[model samples]
Target: MAKTIFITGASRGFGKLWAAAFLEKGHKVVATARDLRSLDDLVNKYGTNILPLQLDVNDRAADFAAIAQAKQHFGSIDVLINNAGYGLFGSIEETTEQQAREQMETNFFGLLWLTQAVLPVMRAQGHGHIIQLSSVLGLVTVPILGLYNASKFAVEGLSESLAQEVKAFGINVTLVEPNQFATDWGSASAAVTTPMPEYDGARAWLQAAASEDKIGIPEATVPAILQLIDSENPPLRLLLGKQGHPWTRQVYEGRFAEWDAWQEIAAAAHGK
Candidate 1:
């Protein structure tokens, strides 16, 4: 069935690809970017099937207004792809308070607000899918992306809780966790902090690693997302890409191992 899909950060990267994919499948798309002009090409190509709106997720008023406009324009929004987030590349110590706040505002709080706005409509209709674009970093930590990792971790936790809360209303929430994909995400959407002498070696390593070509293909994720949208029993968390699965498994296994090793000590704290 053709559905009305609402997407954020649709000017480029995964969001752009998803919007195009849906339009190609003859679905209605309400795509948004920080700048409306950035979506001119999408508007031109998809024509009336795509509604390009200007939106900065951090702006609560703008988010609400956009969601209202989208619901009004399309009559209903069957799916919401919350892909409006950017990376803040830096160690936790190096990242500024303001930068961290901005990261949380966009990646976590913005998603929360938009989901809140759409819940009423979804509840009224009794069915909807909310897809959140998280990352493998959400499951495991890495250097030079502490803030980004924190933001995604928050998204993962929030989305999991949201899924349970909205299930009774027939609203599904899925957190898409993808590893490094071949996108301008690391270059165009990334904000870097000032360098510190102590972290020079780690920073150099990260820079070199980032310069290498990414292994994951952005388009490969489209099918998974589409499947999630159409699924009657979608997972609360869907890890995309080949690397994401093994990497996440490794993280969870290591965590379990540590928990088992420290079980006696952990239990002692309860004074049992």
Candidate 2:
């Protein structure tokens, strides 16, 4: 069962880890990154089993072309891992228009273009699996990470609709929602906005949460991802990390409580 896996953002983080894992498992991987040189080690080790491509996920044209190239190279793509995105650190009031746009462009639009490009190929083959790399923040919002939360929320909603639309086509869609990890995602790799004194108190929770104890090991996610990809019937959403469950449950419970509290208002508004 050596399937071809087309992975975006393969230079580092989960992308790099998963690409190497899949290669070690004898699966052909089309590894893409902004800089192909970043993937040199994977190529050097895995040889022809890995096709390292230079890709800026924001480019729609490049996404389609990359999909075509991968299909032509492997003859079939059994899975797609959209692991390409970065965190944007800023309070909602401090976020700029450019910051919001760029965040959406890379996280949401980029994944959309690639998914659109791969649809036809998967349809023809009659089966495929698409794994979206969302965040636990996608389920519950946190201060200082507003824009990143928005992008992942968009991903969650898009994937929900997509799963229903593609079920008849035998395509499986899964949203992998992971909590904070020990990575450069929110540090060196993130885009930080100028901090404002007004939000300093609001941002304290984030600063306090930034420690080794709060983050999971990036490599620990490999087995969870492998099980997800290898399953015949994968779940629509998979939450990773010990922190994800409690946070998500609390958010959901609060939402239900609010909904129940507002039921009367909702009914009154619906009255004809």
lDDT of 2 by residue, 62-176 (tens): 9999999999998999999999999989899899999999999999999999999999999999999999999898999888998999999999999999999999999999999
In lDDT terms, which candidate is top?
2
lDDT of 1 by residue, 1-272 (tens): 99999999998999999899999889999999978888888788889899999888988988899899999998999999999999998888898889999999999999988999899999999999999999989999878998999999899999989999999999989889888888888888889899788998888887776544546888988888778888988888888887878777888999999999999999999997
Candidate 2 RMSD to the correct structure: 0.9
Q: For all candidates, what are the clash counts?
A: 0, 0
Worst 10 residues of 2 by lDDT: 205-214
**How far out, in Å, is residue 187 in model 1?**
0.5
TM-score of the candidate numbered 1? Answer: 0.96
Point out where model 1 deviates above 4 Å: 207-214
TM-score of 2: 0.98
